[model samples]
Target: MKTIATASMGVTVALSLVGTAPAFAVGGSFHCDRPPIMEVMEQVDGSSALQSIVNQYLVRWEARNATEQCQAYADGRPYDISCMNGRRDWPAILASVPKDYFGRSNESLAAAVRDEKRKGNGLREAMAYCRSVGAIK
Candidate 1:
């Protein structure tokens, strides 16, 4: 990683790079932080289990009402967003999805919610996915 001094929005800032390009900018008029959504997407892409959770949600969303869709997503996983181990919460779930699945989809958040409504899978599947992705064990 490398750091560079730059100016933005009338403020001087420091930018940090990963590999060869800048990844984040700090102490600037405009700051870039990794939103939970993007971060979770990265995590999800890296983990089979987390991706399964997202897929499960998508499947359920196709078959149920909004509330039922949300419920089906949880599948009685104990916590609202966590798997058995409690590491993956709603934010983590959001971050775990693959970026390509959402890029330029324009309404991925809503789409993902809708996907969760199409449920056939259950809590066991979700837990298994979580475990597979190493989000839980």
Candidate 2:
């Protein structure tokens, strides 16, 4: 019975993943017009170079807005959807992962292989810069 339950739970998780909308990861084939907010946030926040000098509350607010803006861009919604929280006048920054080399069919094999790793870092770098600045600012 325990083994059956474990197998059923695994199946349930797999089904849930299949039913969800496609989310592009770093190495995924899906072209992400916008980065996954949390993934980028983790990268940015994990950076040892960044230090917090601003008020804690304000910092948290900035982080929240950054996350919302990224999510909005990913969902094809207005980038300022999270502006209701505060800082409505600010423009949104949508960080994108460039797939030019891997996305095109005309690329050389070497280029495709070389760009795979860079493509992953592209999202992380862009998102980290945009999102981390807000939190650290």
Estimate the TM-score for candidate 1. 0.20
**Each candidate's lDDT (Cα)?**
0.32, 0.31
Candidate 2 residue-wise lDDT at 98? 27
| Candidate 1 lDDT over residue span 17-122, tens digit each | 1111211111111112432223233444322223334544432332122233234334643323211122234454455445555433324454553454353434
Residues 36-105 of candidate 2 have per-residue lDDT tens digits of: 3322223222111111101111223344555656565565565542222222222222122222322233
Report the C-alpha displacement of residue 33, candidate 2, in angstroms: 27
TM-score of each: 0.20, 0.24
Candidate 2 segments exceeding 4 Å error: 1-54, 81-137
lDDT of candidate 1 at residue 27, scale 0 to 100: 16
Top-lDDT candidate index: 1
- RMSD to the true structure for each prediction, in A, is 16.5, 17.6
Task: Give model 2's TM-score versus the native structure.
Answer: 0.24
Model 1 segments beyond 4 Å from truth?
1-41, 44-100, 105-109, 124-137
